[model samples]
Target: MQTNNSVLVTQQIKTWLEQVVIGLNLCPFAKRPYKQKQVKIAISTASDDDTLLQDLLQQFKLLENTPIETTETSVLVVTNHLQDFFDYNDFLNLADALIEQYNWQGVFQIASFHPHYQFAGTTEQDPENLTNKAPYPILHILRESSLDKAVESHPDVDGIPEQNIAKMNQLTKEQITELFGYLKD
Candidate 1:
């Protein structure tokens, strides 16, 4: 039932999750859900903003209606389009609007990832951007209740970003390229 491209993308995402994310301890919270098979990766074929928004809403609804134990979160991988970081960033507003419209604001939150995820005001080459950068554009949808629980249980939740940035900064460009070779053009 799966296309070749779909299978490949899913496997690539799994590799990134296991190797880059968990291997480097970039996201301490990711390993558990991934290991438990609760993280769903949905590939979207929408080639433009209009269609992508529809695809986003559908994923949002799927996560909302599904049982939490079976599905904790979803990553909407926009492989057909939104390769441009700014375009991907701008589309998030529409995603939030849809969430608000469906009254799912508190139920879910969106985190962004892309190949070139530069935070505002930061230089493009800043290693800190690696925190959010992925092999493709991804909108990570998470349940707020679970997130809140995780945050409440953590001793130093506030230090996570600083720690991630510091960790990423230690890697030189060659190291990053070697680790994330698939992302290169």
Candidate 2:
């Protein structure tokens, strides 16, 4: 399998997100519906990163009665891997699941460092389109030379530290799967 620093960074972020979700007592999917005030983040190398997405949904399902269906969802799909960089078929499948199965009507907020970045099968015409071309306000994080660069480029009123994109270029599928599963038990 291909490997590089980008993969490592992706793994780190995924692991961090999973840990945060559980640590914040947001596990067992059923609990998510009531915590409407929480600004939860779900990160992945790609939106189609099945290992991460499936685990998230399964965990959410564990605690809530809401159908595992996604609905008008607002989420940030962070990645160094852009739409053209990965398999298009996988991306489409991910979108289908989110739109049809999950009932997610909210825009999918995508944050990527790729110049050709685009969410698969998502167009500006779709109500879910939330990107550079769209008019809706978005928070996009991109690659920079350092954490300082990220901060300088993407500033916040609260003085939050800009998240440095990890170089995730050396990870195996098993490693990725293990990382994705690290938070539950």
Candidate 3:
């Protein structure tokens, strides 16, 4: 059963995906799966890393068992933990290890998003960090095959990061606040 808080959180994520991600074309490939309703949003209320990993495993299993036509991808929203960017970044190692442990390296991959997702050598205030910032910590589970297909079809797949950074740089303060208001509180 979904609680009111979970419902609200899911709605916020969906809004961000639609308005910031798709609206600004941060991810050129997101629109189709989103429009097709093949994206699964799973909320995790774990307050500790161990519990969070269990939640993550559940999502991984879900993706592993489900067919691609039914669910193309999943976003596991970690609501109660990893609020610190550094901790979240470090936790990615464990996430990657889990994939290797299961020998799912080429079968599945995880893309991370967080409320404060600063890249290496970049300060917290850098505009480019907004490219991966989200309302909450998210582990996006993607099918490796699907990604290969997307990459093969995209005309300039390697330029996506540069394009996203350029878009982030163009955002005004007001626009950033409007699009990412959840981060304010």
Candidate 4:
């Protein structure tokens, strides 16, 4: 069930997501092949499920140099799966290049789907809790979320696919607060 507050939050999220979609230039679905195919495919966060991403990549390769705008044929990825050994810059650089060259625009965002409100935590039984515990700029995300936890906490966003994990990006608290206007003490 949703409360009036939730309803308002949803509306806010919808509005922001819509603007994001336009800024990123994304569509719900790619146009049909015979219908001046506008979209290419959906990009989801890296996951155990590669079916969607793979299929989209295949279609994209088939029509190289098609002159589609960055927003026309891409979806931001959203997922919570990853390996321990991951390089952030390398990944972002590669992803950014592909988008620039292919004219694909959108954020490939990822979230751990963890319930914790903070970015850093450790196992309850760990002797030191340092091995698995690492500090992240999650507080910033929460600061962003604080503006409207309901919307920021979306289980699923319908805009472009989120490409990377919800790591601490450079977005300022003010920027996030602006993105979500419900922040209140």
Candidate 5:
């Protein structure tokens, strides 16, 4: 069901992941799955919260049913609804409730990303916001097993956010603006 636009958006996400994330060592764990072709990117077309929840459930099942080595993770990209960061942020509650609704506790987790991602206690212009900002709203779905392995190997997990903030703070405004422009359109 992926259209041309869906392909384009997923490609853009890949570009961002390569050029900014793995390229900059922002996520030390990302490179492995990406290189092994274990990453699944799906462009969601749901226009409402309920439909979006269903789409997420479907993706969750797809990843769960597939072999771990085949697809270790999935990124559900939403280019349709939840453009507003506040709404997108609030939607995580619903997303989390789905895991409980289906008795999927400890089986999956959803990480949020948005074009205008702003961390709590920070303003919109804060450089640290760049850490989670993406070309579009996305739900990064990861198997709890995979995450457990990743976390076990990464002893400095708690320091990641601080390191990302410091890294983004090192960039000048021009560089940040250029990267943001590349991500958008």
Candidate 6:
């Protein structure tokens, strides 16, 4: 049962991934899986932590049951909860604990993205923080094996963050507004 708002939210995320994440080459590994339609964008309408945790577990189970070729990764879009960056950041600890509790630590990993993502030592308006910002709070579930393969094949895996930050720094004010217009709302 998906609502129009859910559909719109999913589309907004897809656009962000395509135009910003992959188009700008922020993630070298993303283009392949995305183009192959192996990326799953799941929208969670949960407004509470408990329900959100359940949704996250379902995503973990889905990835565990599905093959790599069929579904390489999943981005769980949290629509109603964790809008506050601090709360979202705090919830990541519980997300990790859940992985450990389920013994999925080695099998899966979670990457976070949020509308107001801010890295440590960076101000809220810092351009570098824009690197992780998305239309809504997102829990990007990734397969450890696939990530290992990608890292093994890539030449400079450790440089990706620095490179992304540099790219974000290079963007003009107008360019930032153009790319992240949804943030204005």
Ranking by lDDT: 6, 3, 5, 1, 2, 4
lDDT of 6 by residue, 1-185 (tens): 77899889888999999999998999999999999999999998899889999999999999999999999999999999999999999999989999999999789999999999999998989999998999999999999999999999999999999999999999999999989987885
lDDT of each residue in 7-60, candidate 2, tens digit only: 564455444434433332222331342254233333444343665455445433
- Worst ten in a row by lDDT for model 1: 176-185
Off by over 4 Å in 6: none
Error of 3 at 25 (Å): 0.9
Query: Against the hidden true structure, what lDDT does model 3 obtain?
Result: 0.93
Go through the candidates in order and give each one's C-alpha lDDT.
Answer: 0.87, 0.34, 0.93, 0.32, 0.89, 0.94
Candidate 5 local accuracy as lDDT? 0.89
Deviation in Å, model 3, residue 162 alpha carbon: 0.7
lDDT of 4 by residue, 1-185 (tens): 65575455344434433443232233222123213534332223345424433433444454443443322332222223322223332243444455456554432222221111122353433222211121110100011112243345545554323321221133356654553333221
Candidate 3 structure quality by residue, lDDT tens digits, 19-122? 99899999888999999999999999999989998999998899899998889999999999999999999999999999999899999999989999999999
- Comparing 2 with 5 on lDDT, the higher-scoring candidate is 5
Candidate 3 deviant stretches above 4 angstroms: none
Question: Over all chains combined, what TM-score does candidate 6 have?
Answer: 0.98
For candidate 6, list the clashing residue pairs, or say none: none
TM-score of model 1 (CA atoms): 0.95
RMSD of each: 1.2, 15.3, 0.8, 15.6, 1.5, 0.8
- Candidate 6: lDDT of 135? 91
Cα shift from native, residue 36, model 4 (Å): 11
Residue-wise C-alpha lDDT for candidate 1, range 1-185, written one tens digit per residue: 87999999998888888877888888778888889999999999899998988888888889878998899999999998998888888898888898899999789999898988899889977889888888889999999987998888788888989999998989888879877776576
Q: Name the candidate, 2 or 6, with the larger lDDT value.
A: 6
Instruction: Give the clash total for candidate 4.
Output: 20
Give the least accurate 10-residue stretch of model 5, judged by summed lDDT.
176-185
